[model samples]
Target: MRVLMRVAAGVLILLLIAAVGFFALAWKGEIEPVAAVDRAQFDQELIEQGARLAAVGNCIACHTVPGQPAFAGGLALPTPFGTIYSTNITPDPETGIGKWSEEAFQRAMREGVDREGNHLYPAFPYDHYTRVTDEDNRALYAFLMTRQPVNSTAPENELPFPYNMRMILAGWKLLFFEEGAYHPDTAQSEEWNRGAYLAEGLGHCGACHSPRNRFGAIDPERHFGGGEAEGWQAYAINTESPAPIPWDQESLAFYLRQGWHEHHGVSRGPMAEVTGNLGLLPDSDIAAIATYVASVMGEPDAERQARAEALLAEVSQSQSPALVDAAPAAAAQPGSAQGDGAAIYAGACAGCHDGSRPQPFGGLPFSLSTAVNAPNPQNIVNVVLYGLPPADGEATSVMPAFGGVLNDEQVADLLAYMRERFSDAPAWENLVELVARTRSGEHKVAIRPSDGIERGPENVGASGGAED
Candidate 1:
């Protein structure tokens, strides 16, 4: 009995010691004071600078709910666990960042901690924000501060049990978050460095472009080779991508500035929103991003290269004979002979889709275009239905929504015309089916190709039609 009593006593002492040690560590981890800033000294130039940074970061895209004031957050971002609503960052005393000091803002941006010292979820992208330069951070703060404050409170995040507990985020941060500003590469040019900083840091491109590990944290080693977000497969941005079209700096800039590029392709899915927002940024910044992305094109591994090459080869070899036969049938139709497609194309699409015309406004020629020529018809269908805006930085182009103007048949006709005139690819009867499936609520704004049934090589020419 005495020995048992001594064992219990030892266990109690150990527990007490552990409890004390944990408390001590928690106390030491308490957040420190924020650095001071003189808001009174802030000027118009700084405010404009802030606005530019905000554009680069695409802050409004995630923060502003439809019908809500800009930056007055209420956007629900769906994650693997549940939906997390964005917080209002406007300077409203009751509901926004009005109470936050510069230091608190910096802490949240750099360390993934909130003003209350609670660890912020990685959904906020603080892991990438940690790389933003202090100067840019200050500018962004200034811009956000000057915005009109709306007194709307965002809804609480509906995360799973232990994840719901904000304190547990501290452990998540310990595992994933890194502290500090961007370290400029001395060997790289200033433009490249600037682009790198923006893409990896404030822009948080990695949040969407980089692959994630099992824990839902980004796989840093993979960088921006591509990944999935909110069920949408954000296509690989790397140079070795299996995409039918390869991206170059000029094409990248055109895509960034205008949303669509000749031979490369148009931005669709979640990227359309990104391009719409990026359309507001300056041209130089867009060019810088393009330059940086172009520089990093050779990073894909051997397996990826082999797979991409095989897919390309298969696509090339499998050009449909039936599609080639159907071209004459389309051209022989009396209405088509009278240029029915031409009138519709000219009237509805001419403003933005003139192919290879050397004009900034119209789309480059669909004839022989890689996007048009690709075996998969999803890209063309998506562009026509949703339309695309130019990139935010220099050379902005806006793609008007044709959802109202064109019917499913008209869209099909246009696609058929483009395919017939440009490439030997087959006509897509599945396009109407694809459109209906995409229009269904199953997909969010972005069309997830994987969400739908995939047609196999045999089905490609067989009776397997697209699902409506």
Candidate 2:
């Protein structure tokens, strides 16, 4: 009985020790709140700098619900664990961060803690934010604090028990979080380092581009290899990129700035929001990001370079007046799936995507599209089904939605045909199912306007079908 009693005591003591240690790791003292500062208190220059950084961070995209107060924060972010709603960062005294001092905001950005000392969920992407310098954090604070405050509390996170507990995030951090400002590499150029800082830090590009492990931490080994965002495949920006034409710094800068490139099609999905926001950044910053990203992509191999060159030459030749009037790619045999798909493409896609006109205002040839060559067909499926909506009061690439017209089998057949015609990549498996899920909204997708190019719409996205 004495031995058993001692054993129980030992167990209890160990539990007590663990509890203490856990609390120690998790504990953060609340900072005293201060009255919201007047906008005049912050320097105009600093606030403007903060505005650019906020754009880099894409804050409005996540924090602002459509038609809602900007930065009011009611956007629902769905994660593997559950839906975590964004909190109001607006300077509302009661529900927003109005009372938060610079120190409190700094702590939240650097340590992923709230003013009240609760551990923030990783969904907030503070792992990347931790790399932001104190000066930058100050600027961000100034900018957010001066924003119009709206009295709104985010809906409670729908996370189940244990997962909903903020304490568990400390464990997650212990395993995955590395808290520090970005360290510059001596070997790299200043431009490269600047790009790296912004891309890896404020941009948090990896949060969406890099694949995550089961624990929801980015898989370090496969950084920038590729990942998914909002039901769309964020294609590999690294050397593993599926883009038939390799991305150079110039092309990347153009794409990032103009939202479209001749070699690559217009940005869509979450990336569309990114490019749209990036417009606020200066050309230098965009160039730096492109430089850094291009370095990450590295130089293409001899074989790939040769292929890209050949493809560019081929596309150029194909777009010439003589070939423009020539018949489209050969039709598949009649009474077959491939044939039906070919017919559909001829009627609905080839008219715009015929490579007869330049992109932005013209359809991008499938041969150059990253979506067509991607390992997964989710992006292409999305583009085909939902198409690009024209931006309000803006001239942009517009594609008519085929979801209302095409059935699952038809869409799948069409995509399969495009895959065979445009890319040497293997045919996608279970495409019909993917199309069905995306169409039925079983797989949720975030749709945004393709407003990258400033050119007036002409033949771009013309499905060659009668108006609805």
Candidate 3:
């Protein structure tokens, strides 16, 4: 018994010593932060480039809270540990990074430390940001410093116990963080390489799109397979899409550029914000990102894709043909009474989404829609429950939310009906529960598409129209 106790004590002491050493080395990183007085001067060009880089980083998305000054940073990000509010990143000296030196800012990005030499939470995504070039970091600093300074102070993080200990993040970083700049693939083209850099580095698409392990590290093998963010599904840009149509370069570029592609469907939830930021990027940059992602995602089975597309086309033509007026055609298989799936679609959804209206107002042929054909019908449910809002603050045509009007079973029936008619994919299970969960705000957009072919027309992009 004494020996066992002695051995346990020794192990505890060893762990204590190791923890102390880890903290010392993590904080004593090679970076020598520059003095505040030695910060770089902000050039106009640098500011503009910084703005572009910021867009690439999607800085404003997480930093700015709704109805708040941009970059004043009060958005609360929910993690498994607890909620962490985004810090003020505007040029305010007290609450923001206004007083930070270039090296301090660089250290924060590269080493995950703050101006005060404290470990920053990985929620800031310094893990991926570490790969950003020094030049780009400087530009980001310039852009940030030039922004309108706000004095808003974010609420403190609400983490529990040891997880709340900022010191623990050092170990997390040690375990997972790999600091460096992106190295382009020599075998790939310049465009492809640039896209790779953007996707892997500044864009940090995988951070949100890739599923995380229990340690809160992204599962590398499932990169771009789709993940959750801010209560929305970051759809897979990989081959694992539930999208009926395979995404190619042209389709992706169109979706990213317009936020609404005819066949792919409109961006909503978090993706709308992403597409909005992508709009600020150069066309070539957009094209490059599309090129790389499409290549990596590769194509789905060609034969499966063809059959689904054909099925979708036939369904659309037969069930919801172009209307002579604003009226929908008779239902193929009417339900005996109210709440029948086809009847519900015709009465509630078909007028706007039957592909019977003019450009920008009509819906995609159900066969070509990414939403209906998605592996999970949550996107369809999202549209049905919350309705599609004006994207990017632009008052494009809008769809009314059905949360107040439709019951859970009704929504489920409508969705199942859509899958049955528009897609040859297997009908989703637990739809009633899915709708209820979505209504209660417990559901997220699907990251992984269920096994099936996502068939659709090529280049069928973010088309102008309201689709359910």
Clashes within 3 Å, all models in order: 23, 0, 13
Ranking by lDDT: 2, 3, 1
lDDT of every model, 2 decimals: 0.64, 0.85, 0.72
Candidate number that wins on lDDT, 1 or 3: 3
> Candidate 2 deviates by what RMSD?
6.4
Instruction: Put down candidate 3 lDDT per residue, 1-468, tens digits, no spaces.
Output: 343343444444434544874755556443453434323466788888999989989899899987799999988888765689999998787788777778888888988888887788888988788889899999998898888889999998987556567666666666667878888789999999989888788889898889876657788889888877766666777878767667789989987776666665666677766777776799999999999999988877878678667756764564444441323234445554223777677777776665555323455567667677767666777777876655433444357778889899888888887787677778889999988888876644422111101112334334643444
Compute the lDDT of residue 318 as modeled in candidate 3. Answer: 49
Task: List RMSD in Å for every model shown.
Answer: 12.4, 6.4, 7.1
lDDT of 2 by residue, 1-468 (tens): 343343344444434544664676758889998876677899988998999999999999899998899999989988766789999999999999998999999999999999998889989999999999999999998899888889999899897655677776766776678999999999999999999999999999999999987657898899898988888889889989999999999999999987888889888889988988898999999999999999999999999999999998888887765664444336656678888898889888887887766677667888998999999999989989998877645543377889989999999999999898889999889989999999889889998877565432445544432233
Expressed as tens digits, the lDDT of each residue in 180-260 for candidate 1 is: 889999999999998898888877878998888645689878888777655455666775353544566887887777655
Off-target runs (Cα >4 Å) in candidate 1 are: 1-41, 299-439, 446-468
Q: Which ten-residue region of model 3 has the weakest summed lDDT?
A: 447-456
Global Cα lDDT for candidate 2: 0.85
State the weakest 10-residue window (summed lDDT) of model 1: 448-457
lDDT score for residue 215 of model 2: 58
